[model samples]
Structures are given as C-alpha cells and as structure tokens.
Target chain A: MNYNLPVLLIAIPILFSFLSLILGSFNKILSKIILISVIIFNIISGICIYNSVLKNGNILTVIGNYLPPFGINLISTYTSISFLILLYIVFLVASLIFVSKNDDRADKISSVLLLYLASSTGILLTGDIFNLFVFIEIFSISNIILISIKDKKLSIKGSLKYLIITSIGASLYLFGIGFLYGILGTLNLSEISLNFDNISYFSKVFIFLFFLGSIMAELEVFPFNFWISDSYAGSKNYVNILLSGLSSIVALYIFIRLFLTVFGYPTFISFSYSLPFNVKTLFLTIFGLSVIVNELAALSSKNVKRILGFSSASSLSLILLSLSTGLKNGVMAAMLIAISVIISKPLLFLSSHQIMKGKGEKNLNSFIDGFRRNPLFSILFIIGVFTLVGFPLTPSFWGKFLLFISATEKISYTTLILVIVVFSITIELFYYFRLMHKLFIKDENIKVEKTKNNFVYIFSGILLASIIIFFSVKPYFTQNIVEKTTEDIFDKSGYIKSCLKSGEIDDR
Target chain B: MMIDNRTLYIYSFIIFLIGIYGAITNRNLIKILVSLSIIETALNIFLVSTGYINGSNPPILHSGMKLISPNSINISDPLPHALVLTAIVIGVGTTAIGIGLTIKLYNHYKTLNVNRMGDKDEL
Candidate 1:
C-alpha cells in the first residue's frame, strides 16, 4: 500500500542474502529458512504493490529523496509487478528444489539464489538506464557463478563461455548508455524517452544498434547466443529453470521497455530522413531466423536439456517476432506466450530431472518407461511439453492463436514470418512428441531401478501444473492481466509522465 | 595543443573494437578474459570522456561561487564519474570471477586453450 514497496522488493532480498550467508554459517537449515521466508515476503509485497498499482496507477519510488531525472528511481508498473510475482513464485519453487539437494554447499547456493532474486527484481523495477546495466551485470555474474558452482568440468566450461560473452555484451551496452548520456545528458529512462526524438538520426541509429546488439546477446537471440546450449545443458536442472524461465523473461522485458517505449517505435518510423532499411523487417528476420534455427536444432539434439534450451530460445524468439508486429494483439500474444514459458519451463525441467534420477545419462532413451515408473511426473512432463508445443487447453495454444490472428491482420512479411514460424512449430511438435512417445514406450527388456521420489519435485510439479491447467480452464483469468500489461508497455507517454513528474505517489 | 573529443572518441572506439576482436579470436581462456577487461576499460574511458567538459571546474561548490542558473550548472557533470566508478567495481568483480573460473577450468582440462579442451559435449 506504500510507495516504499518497490524499494523493499529489491532491498529485502539483498539484505537477506547477506543475512542468509551469515546465518548459514551457524546452521545450514537457518539459511534455507531465511531464503524461503524472504521469497514469501517478496510474494506478499508483490501482491500489495499489485493492488496499489491497480488503484493508484504506476508508483515511482525515488531513492534517498534525490527526485526524478536527478536520482535513481524504481517504477512499479502493471507489467513489472506481475512479472515480479511470477518470478517470486518460480524462485520459491526453485529454492525448494535447491534445498532438497544433498550437497555440502547448499548454504552458499541459497545465498546465491537470493542474490539472483534481488538482481532480477532490480532489473524489473528500476527506471534508470545505468541502474539497469548494473542490475544486468549482477544478474549475469550470479548466473555465471551458479552454472559452475558444482565444479563439474562441463559446467565450468559452460560458465567460462557465459562469462566471456556476457562481459562483452555488458561493455557494449554501457558504451551505448554512454553515447545516450553524452547526447541527452540524462540516464533516467523516462527522461530519455521524452527527449529521444530530438537527437540526430545517426546517433539514434547507432545507439539503437548498440542497445539491440547488447540485449540480443543477453536475450539469447540467434546470432549472439553461442553460449546458450552449453550453459543450459551443463548447469544443474534447477539452475536451468532459473536461466530459461526467469532470466530470459527479464531480458525480454528490457528489450520491450527499451525498444518499444523508450525509443518510441512510432517516432522511429515517422522520421523524415530516409532510413537505411526497414526496422520491423529487420526484427522479423532476426527473430524468425532464431526460431527456425533453434527449432531445427532442438529437433536434431539428443540431450534433453539441450533440446529444452534450444526450445526456450526459439520460444522467446517467437515472442519477439509477435512483438515486432507492433500491434496491441501482438503484445497480448507475447504476454500469453511468456506466461506459458514462465510456468512450463520449470515443470518440464523439474519433472524431467525426477524422471532421469538414477539414470546414467540424460538422453531420450532414459525416458523409456517413464510413464510406468513415475506416472504423475510423466503426466506433468506431458502437460509441459504439450503446453510448449501449443496443444489445446494450454496458454501457448492461445498465444499462438492470437499470434496468427495478429499476423494475418498485418498481411505482409509478417505472414511470411508466420509461415516460417508455423513450419518451425511443426518441427517443434515433431521433437516434443518424440520425447513424449519415449515416455510411453513399454520397454520390458530392461529392469528399471526405483528412483527415490523427491517430494519437493512432485509438489512443485503439481503446483506449476495446476497453475497451467488453471489458466487453461480459465483463459480470461490471465487475459485480464496480460491485456493490462500490454497497455502498460505501449503507453510510452504515460510512462514518461509518471516517471518525470515530481512524484505524486512518492513516500516522502 | 589538445586532442579534440573526436580523436578521443575514435581512440576509444578503436580500443573497443580491438577488445572485441581479441575476445572473438583468442582460443586461450585467459586471453579472452583479458580482452573482456580491456573492453570494460575502453567503455569506462568512453563514459568518463562523455561527461568531460573543457575548461570547466570540477563539480564542487565554494563560497562566493556564482551559479550559472537555477536549472543549468557551469561545472563539469559529475554523474559519469560516479557511474564509471561503479562500472570499475563491477568490472573487478567480473574479472575476479573470470580468474576463479579459469583456475577451476585449468584443473579440469589442464590447458588454457579452448580448442584443446576437446569436445566433451556431443550431439
């Protein structure tokens, strides 16, 4: 109900991360308690902020009373708060999976997870551009640490590659921010968006390209995503959930915020200077290529996690493709698809992790007789895979439906992209169904060991599955939020006014 | 005689490009990490120079100093200096992590060259 809630959302996790580290030194269980309690607190605060934003509109909390356009501020809009809630839920589930591990470094992992939560919350809430860069670095560094913390050779290699790529991306992004700061003399996002149009066309294009290059690397889009498959496959199963589900969502949020709102796409197209090429067409080609390449890669990959990694890259790219259409319907579709990913990715990884327990290798044949051994988990896996492939009674189905509808309304290269997307989806279908078919194979030749069932995995799987099924049973439940988030993203002027105005909702 | 901002900009850009080239081309992990740090330093230089104003006093207030106006100030912008400090701190953190990981990696593969790490991952 108060304006300090945004700061609390970021600060609490950070404070507790250190507290968790200290407490874990005394008793490892204490650290797990602190981690869960902090995530629960985040969910509660997120609900309060969501309620307040619904009543009072976007709330801007300027830090240390420095005021907007001069000081750092956190903006809690409809889109960001809802995603914060989703991320908290996912983190809570992930922490549970993480807590159940038998590793001696559990305490340290808890602290890292809490730090990841804090940085992600910061990335979502901050309205300052340089602050966003800082949060992104924290986010990426934490990810690099998590990927290799187990010290497996494969994971260390993956982590090394991630470190190099992200470091380069962050440097390029900072350079872009510097370019903008030199030109506009401000780092507040709303102020930049307000004054973005006055800059010379060349500077605008250069800055945009820099921002795009950096974010695409972060977003795991086609050209700059060399680190994805190795990192995804090499990390722990729970870590894969955080990487594919939470981090990609936050990066996509940044992409939308910077490209659609701050740069003002309408102003971009309406520029009187003759453009070098069509921006929308460029976006469509990039994302479309990602979709095609990743889907085809997913189809050919033998490793399950690698397949999921490639699938997630393509799914996020499809979301980007829909977004490039620049229609309200397209944004709505993107929101639905993102929600599907945020829910289903964890379920797939969690269930598959359970199914693969006691198996020597994480491959397709390992899934044989999965239904006979762990029926509930196999069912959950089916739901997750179906949701990914856009079967009926799933949010992804509706997302793809809306995507097709929106693409048809445009009736141009979008249709061509849509055709490519549809072709990719068929490939997606071929692979996911192949995975599902492995689950049901009645293999009588081999004696399967009874793997110990992790109740945490089962409980989290059911929880995530029910969320998907709930959304499927009641599509409108999610649509209301998705529609509002879409509007919040597109309302660039409203964002500028709220951010630059001497805060009406300021706590001070 | 002073070098203009154009030359400085070009210099930083060239440094940035060199870092990128080394990062992409180097097969040794430590070399790649060094390239990344080079890139970070180049960015910090670019950012600090962006806020530099010729012949302007550092952004500090003294007694009897006249303000340019209510909204605009006569002193050089201090924000980029603060930003570059934070960026340097972050760069240090990243570099430290890179070194730690490299140590772990060397223990595993016994080689710094990425090409010699061999294909542990397969299709």
Candidate 2:
C-alpha cells in the first residue's frame, strides 16, 4: 500500500495533540489513556515508515500533491525517520511523566501539549523553508507555553522571556529566508542549495551570517542565547524534558538542513583563506570552547535542572562540534550523541523529579540517601549519570570515542587535539564527579522511608538502562541507520532527479 | 519589486536593529513590548519584500495584463505575503499573551520594571 507515511506520522500526532487537549479537559483518565495510545501508535507507525523507507531508500510524502522547488514537499528520508522514532520515544516517556500523579500542569496543559509535539515533529518532516518557518513559529510558541504550564508567576515570567527572545529569533529566521528567496527566488531547499553558488559573493557572506543569526538563537551557544538560563531554569521538569530533548533536536535538525544542505561550503567568499581553518575545523574549535564554558557554568549551578540544562547545552555544543567536521564519521558521532541525549536525558529528568521535593532543592546532598530511599531508581540514576559522563562500556563512551576518533582522523593534528580532548574531558569530568561524589558522600546523612516506585518509573528504568547498554555495545545498531541517512543527504543528484523528474508528481 | 528596491531590504534591517537595541536597553515592560513589535514589523516587511514583483499587482491573475509582456510577467508573490500575514497574526497573538502575563505580574509585584518584578529564587 502506498501509505503516504510522512504526512501520516506528522498528521496523526497533530490531530491527537489537539484531541488529547480536548479529551483531557473532559475526561482526564480518558485523555491520559488516549494520549498514551496515540504516542504508542506514533512509535509503531514511525517504525513501520522507517522500515519501509529503509527498504525503499527514500520516501517523499508531498503535501496535497505539491512537487519540489516550487510546491511545498515533505521528504521522509532515513535520518528524519530515525529522528521521528526518537522523538516518539521521548514523547512517550514525556507523556508518561506528564500524566503521572506528580506533574502539576499535566492535566491542565494537555490541550496544547500534543499540538507542540505535532509542530515539532512537523518541523522535522517539512520540505519547504517557509513551511519550516511556520512549524518553527508553532513549535516556539507552543514550547514557550509548555514551559510556562506551571502557571506560577516565575514560570510565566520565564515563558514570556523565552517567547520574546525566540519569537524574535523566528522572525529573524524568516527575514533571513526573505533575503535568500529574494536572491534565489525559491523556498524549496534543494533548489536554493543548487542556486546558492550562483548568488553574489556579498550575498553569500550575508547568507552565512543569516544562518548564524537564525540558528545561533536556537543553538543557545553563547551571546545569542543569553536567555537560556532564565528560560530553561525554572520551567517544569517534563516541559524542560521536551525543551532539552525534542526541541533542541528539532533546532539542530534545522541547523543541519540549513548549514549542511544549503550551504556546506560556499565558494563565493574571496576571503575564505583569512581564517586558518576550514568549516569543519571551525565547528570543532568553537564547539570545543563551548564545552568548557558550559561545563564551568553547569558546575556552579545550584538548581539541579539548570545543571542538567547546562550539561545538555554543553553536550549539544559537542554534537555541533562533531558536525563541524563535515565528514560521514562526524555526522555519525552527532547522531549517536543525539540518541544518547534523547534516551538518557529524559531518564535523568524523570529521576530528578522523583528525587526532589521542589525545583531548587535538588542539590548534591539530596541524593545522598537516594539509594536507601529508592534503591532501584537511585541505581538507575547513577547509570544515567554514568552514561552522561561517558563512563567506559556505556553508550556515550562509544559515542565519545567515535567523536574523538573522528576529530583526530579528520584534523589529524596529534598535539593540538590531544590538548583539546583532554581539557574538554577534564571540564566534563569535573562537574560529573563533583555531583557523583555528592551523591555518594554527604555530611548530612538523613534517613528516608522507601516510597513505592511507580509502574511507569520502573518501566522507564528498564527501558533507558537497556537502551543505554544496547547502543553502547552494538554501536552499529544505530550507526547503520545513521550512515544510510547521511548517505541519502549527500546524494545531491538523486534529490534533484527525484524532485524534477519523478514523472507524475505523487502529491498524496 | 513593488516597493522601492533600496528601501525594501535596508529599512527592514534598520528597524530590526532598532528593535534589538530597544530590547536590550529598555527597562520598562511596555517599552520592551513595543520593541518586540518593531522587530516583528521589520521581519514581516522583510518576508513580504521577497515576494514582491516590479510594477505588478497582487496575485489575483484576473486576465488584466494578459497582453502585457509575459516575460516581464509581474505578480507580487502571494505566497510570501501570505506567510507574512500568518506571522503577523501570530505576533499579535503572542503579544497579547505577553500583555496578559505582564498584567498579572504587575498586579502581583506592583511594578512595570522587569528588573524589579520578581524574587531571586523565582526569577
């Protein structure tokens, strides 16, 4: 059956996202049940679609018969499918966490929550830049709302701050697209990428800056994202899970689409040699620096979520660093890290929520007696922290190994990289062991009663631990999928031929 | 382009710069909002400018200029303008939400200055 799967996966969630909201308002139990069903269905269908695409090589679910370059299109290439599957998994966990007894806004906030998922998933699936903008707007607005779901005064303030900054960010993104369209006269990504070389050199430089202007806001790397702390700090844990997990993934997806596909290495700039490095080298250097800066801030952070936030951002910068290499290996490393963040971050988030009484109380000492209070969960949390820190045999260790090997192989400068990796790992290990030691040893040894672990929490415990260990051992489990995905992305002639010469435009 | 060529791009950028300046420097809640509006306006103008056609009318395609130079066939790109309109409505909607929040915040904290609005832990 010609299932038109791209739009189907996106549309189903989109519909349920709204349906879940309405359902939650009327019957909370039904809402939770339907929401879980919808997410599970999403996961199942994503796998089906992914398996189909894996066999077929590429699947384009063009919206309403729209063709490429001119008409809006949605292509379900391998990477996006992989991303969708990851997204659904995270969404499933998030759904569980949101519907669980603890979250304050789970019931009240269900309306827009599903919509946010649809928007983010839609952003990942769409083909045209303008449509991407639409989804970005939707995702950003929904994200801001989701962040503020707690309805506390501080939450509202933080949401507003996020809304203003990201709204401006989205507008700037649109405005930049405006110029790209002005010069190239098309919003279709592949066509503009082809035509990019023909544009003026001055415009090329401006366009590069335009990419920086738009993506930097989402990257939250430095000066552009000064609001990251204020925005991410006080948000509810589940929404922050979405923010750090799915939303960041969506943003990085857009960055990859823009940076790699449209303008990987523009030849028009005359002063290219002015910089001592190539594009990939630049990605390595800049992101390596962010590793230290973010780690330093993360170490000093008092709020546990903010520390996770910083660490997420820190790890995110490393992924970007890996991507800067512009090699298949680098992309492989990036995808591995992405999967790690998707799985492990949510586990940690749920664990953190379980461990804490309030937002700010999740200090190092809080987890001192965690083993006694909830031994299973506490052990799972340690595994999660170990995974994050890249302890040997964990999936992250392999991912980090790939990143290190890729960087060394690509750059091939033994002394320089030796210093960079050491410093970066040191910076990472410092905060990690600090938090680790705190978990293991503390002056205030308070006794705690054994609380009953939720079935869902136990479920998450089993799921994340296995997946962490699974991918760590067989890196090729995901590596094969990601490698195929990157191969598809780099297939330029295939895309152009597929778009322009696909016989009758299969506009399903 | 429908608009003067230089003004279409340059002015929007200038307005964007002004909005950024205001967002960074302004201490008043309302003023920052006004600046956000400025930024949105600039972006809207920029989005629409990409769709403009020189000496062309809106993309009604009414057979009004069939005999005109088809090579110079000018129809203001309706797609970009439509996207811009959607963005403007969204801008208005988010702004309204922001205003609603600000009102709540002002009532609770009794201040319009964002700096003075919240406690250390909450903010």
Candidate 3:
C-alpha cells in the first residue's frame, strides 16, 4: 500500500508538462532540464512501484477516499507495471534524442511529450472505464498535436485524418460506456466485471461490439489503420518512435485489459447457452487479414518510413493473433512478441533516421552504401531487421518460436494460421533483406554527408540491441517474466477480489 | 412521438446512424467534422438519458431534508450526468482540434474535399 507511487506516477509528469511550458517561456534549457528530470523521476517511480508490486502484489489506490464502484481507482498489476517501466525507458531515450537536436520548437515538443507520457500512464493505471475514456481522448489529442508539430502540409493532413477518425471511435466508445452504465450501474472496471453476468444477452453482445470497434482503431488492426502509414511518414522520426514503440504498446495493453479482462470469455461462456458467433475466431480472422495486408503493403511501399510503419502494424497484428487464442501459453507468447517489438521497433526507427540523415530522399535508394557511411548504425539496422524477421540469436526469434509452439498446442486451423504467418514472414524477409543488400551495395558516386554522430541516438540504439541480444542468449529470464504476467492477466477472480477488497477497506 | 425511455434510446440510435452515414458519405473535411460532432451529440444524449429515472426529482438535497436511509428518496442517477458533462467538454476539445486541422489542410491544399487531397506521399 505505497500510496504515493501510483498517484505521483501520473501527477508528476502532468504537473511538469505545464511547468515545462511556463519554464520554457523563461529559459528553454530550463524546460529541457525539467523534462529530463521528470523522465528520471518516472523511471525511479516505476521501479518503486515494481518493487511494491513484487512485495505486496498489485497496488490499488482509491482516489478521493471514496469506496470503489463509486470513486476512481488506479491499479498496478505486474503486467501494467512492466509496461510502465518499458515506457519510461523508451521516453528517456526519446527525450535524450530530442534534447540533442537544436530545433526551434524544443520547448513545445517537450510539453507535448510530457503530456503524452502522463496521459498514456494514466490510461495504463486507471481502473475506471469512464476514466479510461478521458485518458484515451487526452492520448489521441496529444498524439494529433505531436504529429502536426512540424507544421508541414502532409503531417497536418495525416494528423487530421488521425484526429477525425479516432474522435469518432472515441464517441463510439463513450456510447458503449453509456450502455454499460445503464446496465451495470458502475464505472469501476472490476465492479463491472463482477456484475457483467447480470446484463442481458443482447446488451452484452452489443457492448462487446462497441468496445471492439472502438479499440481496433488504436490497435492498428485492419479497417481502421489506413492512416497509420501516412502519419508515420509525415511525423518526425522521434515521434515515430513514440507511435510505434510506446503508444502501440499502451494501446495493446488497453485492448488486453478490455477484452481479456473486462468482457472476458469465462464470464460469457457461463451465462449464455450458445453464442451466435465465435468471437475469438472473428478476432483471429481480422488479425490474420491485418498481418497479410500490412506486410504485403509494406512490400510494395517504397517509402522507408512507411515500410517500417507497416512492419510495426503487422507486428501488432501478430501479437493480436496470438492473444485471440485464449490460452495461457498464447498470452505468454503474445507478451514475448510484444516485448521484442517494443524493444526493436524503436531501435530501428532511431537508426533509420540516422542512416537517412542529410539525404534528400527517404526511399530505398537513400539507403545505398549505408554501411560505408556509418558502419555502427548499419550494423544496428541489420540487427533490428534480423530481430524483426525472428532470426536466431535475437529476442524476436524466441518470440516467434514460442508463438508457433503455443499456436500448435491449442488452436484450431493451426496449419492455416501457420502458413499465413510463415508466408507473411517470408515476404517481410524479402523486403528487409533487399534493404540490407542495398545498404551493402557499393555506390561510390553517392556523396553522403559525414554528419556528426548524435551520442543519444547511437547509445540508445546500441543499448536496445544489446538488451535484445542478451535476452536472446538467456531467454529463460524473459520466459519466467512473461509466464508470471500471463498468469496475472488470466487470474480474473484474483483481480476482482483484490479490487473489491480494496474497495471494502473504507467501509470497515 | 411519445418520448419514453425506450423511445429516447431509439431516437438516439437513429441519430447515431445518421451521423455514421454522413461521416461515411461526405467528401468535404468540414462535413466530416460536422458528422463527427453529430455522433458525439447523439452519444451525449444517450448518456444523459441513461441517468433519467421516470418522474424522479433532480439529484439534490434541500435544507431540512432528513435522510433516514439510502434509497429513501427517488432521485435520478447523477453519475451519468457527471459523465455527460465531461463528455461534452471533451467533445468540444476534439471539435476544436479537428477544426484547426481542417483550417490547416484547407490553407495547404486550397480545397476541403478529402478526395482531392490525393496521397500524402505525393504531397
């Protein structure tokens, strides 16, 4: 019951966001210092919460001293705390890279980054559904602003599309919340889960549909992610790291929280005599199509940023595909894949910008003789690609291996999914290897600028790569962590009991 | 039309569908933004309506009212009203951001038609 950690984790960054803005008006360097200090504080708080969770098992903080089912609450389980820690690390690296650049709008960017961190952390920690909606809006608005910070025409258009579509999705989500409130009479997540079976069959199905449709946009699944490539290509490279690395992880975590935890299958299976359609199968088909379509699109795309964007989307789909299996092992495999993606995607993005520095074009042609220009970055990029393709001695390899094992163990149509995954992986390999080959191809006539190496970029890239390699070499450590997280996610009764017990404390 | 609880839900649903239809069919960026606002309005109405109790008084306590026990008085649920207030504020913020983006897009392309903007890569 370390009361300060959860509230401070959310409040500190938010307080600093405004503080940084005012401080930036006085001195820009002061604002940057505040941003760095906030991130460092976030890391320390994240570690403290992790330690508390290890000792005390899931800390639930009730806001305003009101009992649960009435007051807003924040819960930090092992899974959420792990994601928070990972998010802090990525933000630390991204902030360092941002400070290294001498952009005119550094103060503005620092404010937006802090707000982004605060809202996303709020989304992860809040246990109330309505609070989740508020956080989602903040997250989306900040994301749009972040995308449009460069004030370029394309970035504006991209952010416009993103804003309009995601706003509509948020409205749909609010509508779903209305229905849930009407039926369940409470906004607390665990309270809703406890009373979920009391809802009528039709209402339950509709609520589930609304939630799925709303979240699918952020998840970057098929039908709602057409704007993703544009946004990725239009924004600055560090923003891409946020979009691909940090935000996507949070989005997936929210999806898991809603689907696997809130409207879980265990509750549904008991109340309903028979389901009209298989929900898991439906999710599987959507994710399957997402994987194929995104990978194929990446294959045809010539823009370097767009290709990486599509690859990130496809990786998200792969994680979703594994999660739809509803087996413990599937959840484990999904976590494994998600961790590797969270690690390597940002590395690739950071290094891609480095490799494309001083280049006029962002096409594959720009990558020619990349190895000659900066050998360290070229090697880092190759390692990133290899990890993405799940080559041996990379963390992604173990993820894919565990995924294949888990998929074969419990899923129907395993061969069909296996084929789709393998086929898509091969297509991905073709394009990635082609890029690697272009990097090695000698082009002496290409005058590459000998740009000074940004220590932040190189250090972050090398750090992530080394982490990936270390995990690959000793995957048992990761396996044990993922196993525990999976158990935490699957323990629905335990989650409810803990939340309700915390809620009951005030009454006694 | 008699406006009962069920009827209110029906009206909101139809409005929501119209918003969705408009959002899908409109080519102009402003029209799309309007459609999104309409959707938000529909949801807000639905949410506020959920808090309504038939013939119940507004949620308030007057002086000299003695509370004997919980549920002693019939009052409409105030939680959904609070939620709707927040929703309306958020809706305004989103609309403002959308309008800002629209202005920027119009200034850049000199047109509001979504189709005419062409591919972002080509821009």
Q: Among these predicted structures, which one has the highest lDDT? A: 1
Candidate 1 local Cα displacement, residue A100, angstroms: 1.3
Ranking by lDDT: 1, 3, 2
What is the number of backbone collisions in each predicted candidate, taken in the order shown? Answer: 0, 4, 0
Worst 10 residues of 3 chain B by lDDT: B1-10
lDDT of 2 by residue, B6-111 (tens): 6777888999999999988998888888999999999888878777766767777665567566556666778777778888888898888778777876887788
C-alpha TM-scores of all predictions: 0.96, 0.92, 0.96
* CA lDDT for candidate 1: 0.85
Better of 1 and 2 by DockQ: 1
TM-score of chain A of each: 0.96, 0.91, 0.96
Q: Is candidate 2 or 3 superior in TM-score?
A: 3
Candidate 3 yields a Cα-based lDDT of 0.84
Off by over 4 Å in 3: A265-275, A447-449, A502-508, B63-66, B119-123
Residue-wise C-alpha lDDT for candidate 1, range A1-508, written one tens digit per residue? 6778789888988998898888899899888888889899999999999999999999888888877898899999998999988998898888888888876777788888888999999999999999999999999988999999767877888888888878878887998999999999999999988888888888888898898889888888887776777788888988999988898679888988888877755432221222355777788899899898888888888889989988888889999988877777778888888989889988999899888777788888889988888888888999998888888868888888888888777767656767876897899889888988998898889876666787898889999999999988997887888888887887777888888885454435
- Candidate 2 wrongly placed segments (more than 4 Å): A102-108, A265-278, A357-360, A410-420, A442-445, A506-508, B1-3, B67-72, B121-123
Tell me each candidate's RMSD, in Å, in order: 2.2, 3.4, 2.3
